[model samples]
Target chain A: MSLEIEVFATLNGIPDEAINNKTVIVIDVLRATTTITVALAAGCLEVIPVLTPEEAIEMRERLGDERVLLGGERNALKIPGFDLGNSPLEYTTEIVAGKRLIITTTNGTRAIRRAAGGRLVFLGAMINAPAVAGLAATAATDITIICAGTRDRFSLEDFLTAGLLVDQLAGQGEFVLRDGALAARDYYYCHRADPAAALKASFHGRLLADLGMEADVEFCSRVGATDVVPVYGGGIIKKAS
Target chain B: MSLEIEVFATLNGIPDEAINNKTVIVIDVLRATTTITVALAAGCLEVIPVLTPEEAIEMRERLGDERVLLGGERNALKIPGFDLGNSPLEYTTEIVAGKRLIITTTNGTRAIRRAAGGRLVFLGAMINAPAVAGLAATAATDITIICAGTRDRFSLEDFLTAGLLVDQLAGQGEFVLRDGALAARDYYYCHRADPAAALKASFHGRLLADLGMEADVEFCSRVGATDVVPVYGGGIIKKAS
Candidate 1:
């Protein structure tokens, strides 16, 4: 089995052919994957990723807002009517446990939808990189890590997270890496020792810091802080259990 | 000024919007850019990149075969009846000096045409990396480097060469790097100590060695071996006089 990592600079940059039957890991380290990982680790029932706010609202209505929490952000700010923003800190065990989250974000949800055709899709971030890599390697299928870049441009945080996952998998399996994978592995090796510093240097990181969310950047930079491997299937993301 | 390096894993992977008004550097380090740089450094008047064998033949007809030499490759082998193959070794000063050459390859020329919409396009490779970086830094425009991956698939050689160029430019100018640029720079830093060893470990490099072109790989891997920066303007690539 071989691993081919395709680093999409943005959702718009992902080729249509990239999502066919492979195990896809969607990474949005500046906080969608981190949030999802936290939610699952905190015992959330499932995270339904919707592409639009209306879909999230509709899902909330169907499931009853009491049972389904609406969570997401637009332009890094919390939606006015939503129960929560995209910050991983909000998905604490006290709040998210046993609740279903209908979420939509500026970039992460769109990337998840784009990757729906994969044989299996997993949410990956620094917080749960080892778990995701472990699951992916055991699957023994070709993997494509999609970076949910900010807006329609590349995001260094997401790419670095994907690189971290690639690094983890490279040690466990013999795989044929694509050019993007090789580049990502090199980037991971170069910045592995100082991920927090690397994240702070990114465009998205600076933007988040400007928004008074530097704490979230520090939170998301913790590699393997959680062991939850959130798997996406049947239109919802949930822990492997 | 800002530098945005968009590393396309393949020619098909490049987005149409990436070329607008940017200074684009097209890299095919395994051969095309290496050959072009060598030809120019060896005193060739110009290298006209064509997309097809017919166009090369037509250009030879238009300029007369005596003045225009035909060169390029289809699958690492010289086109039948062409004056030369896509090899830097064949571009010795004795044969190509003072002659104009029309070239086409499986990937490089296609990538150049893909980047034709740029404000200025330049050919780049490990052989002429320093020269290309110097020209790009002096241009002081938002730059985008296009890697001509092999046959619409990621080629490690081209990407690492782009990384080398990015690393060089990053030191010469103050520029905001895009995510891809940062990744490329990291990759370059990881493998800068010995480009030939890095190249030999790449997919295309292994294939070239299998085809008995180890010498070409060695020649192309030389950093700062030539001072010629080949500029593509008016549909022709010539030394930046």
Candidate 2:
């Protein structure tokens, strides 16, 4: 079987063919994937991704707000009246444990929805790179890694996370890599020694830092920090059992 | 001042915003840019790029057959009755010197047309990377390097060529790089010691080799082999004087 690393530089860049019959790993390391991994690890029962804030709120109402927490962000800030912003730190055990999260985001959720037709969809980040790669290697079909770039443009953080995953997947078994995969692997090697430094220099990283979220970049760059692989199916994400 | 390397994995991947108000360098190093650079270096007066074979034939008819030569390929093979195939070797001084050529191809010309709104457009390849970078550094606006990916899919060769150009441009001036540019530069550094080896392993390169075009890949991988920078303006490409 072949492994194709198809990076959608932005949510809008994903091609229709990428979402069909493939094992898709969606990454938005700047926050979304990081947030999901942390939430699941903190014992959140499930995370439902919606494209819009209204949809997130509606889902929360349907599930009963007492049992569901509204989460997500717009323009890198928490949505008004929502329970959480996109930061991974916000999904603490005290707040998220034992509850369901109805989430929407500026980029990541849109990308996840776009990959809804995949045979298997998983949320990946540096935090869960090895775990995702291990699961991905056993897939019965081709694997595609899609990056949730920032604001419909290329985001360095997402591509770097993809590179880390590609590197891990390559080590697990032999597979034919697409050009994008090769490129991502090469990029990962270039920054493998110092991912935080690489992230600090990225376009989105700098933007986030300017917004006083530099700690998030440092947190997101910690490879293999969590073993949680959040699998998405039937409209919700839950830690794979 | 900034230099952005916007890599479109395929022609279909280019964003609408990437084509405006920038100095765009279009690279299709597998053959088109290599051929165009060679044609100009061997003394072709001008090369006009069109999206279809019929457009090339019509342009030749309008300009008279004696003054215009039809040159291009549909599937790495010459169109029947055309003056030349899409090979740099076919653009010898004896046949094409001082003549105008109308060219079309499966990928490159379409990418060129896509960048038509740019303040300046130039054809780039490994053969003319330094030359293109030198010219691009002088642009009053930002420089955007666009990879004409293979047949609506990402091609390894084009991205590597873009990386080479980004590396060259980075050395010549102070410029902020976009995430795509950073990825390209890092990729180039990973394989800078052996570009031909990297190209030979690419999907398109292997396909071309199977078709007995191994020599073309070797020729196209030669960095700084030519000084010709083919500038596109008024819908025609000519060696920048």
Per-residue lDDT of model 1, residues A70-169, tens digit only: 8999989998899999999999989989898989998899888889999999999998899899989988678888888766555778878878988899
What overall lDDT goes with each candidate model? 0.84, 0.85
Q: Interface RMSD, candidate 2?
A: 2.5
DockQ for all models, in order?
0.37, 0.55
Clashes of each: 0, 0
Global local distance difference test of model 2? 0.85
Q: For residues B1-241, what per-residue lDDT tens digits would candidate 1 score against the true structure?
A: 3455555444654555777788889999889989999999899998899999998898788876587789999878999999999989999999899999999999989988888888988899988899889988888678888877766455778878878888898889887777667767777889888879989888778888999999999999999988888999888898897
Per-chain TM-score of chain A in candidate 2 equals: 0.96
Residue A235, candidate 1: C-alpha displacement in angstroms: 2.2
TM-scores of the candidates are 0.90, 0.95
For model 1, how big is the iRMS in angstroms? Answer: 3.6
lDDT of residue B227 for candidate 2: 91
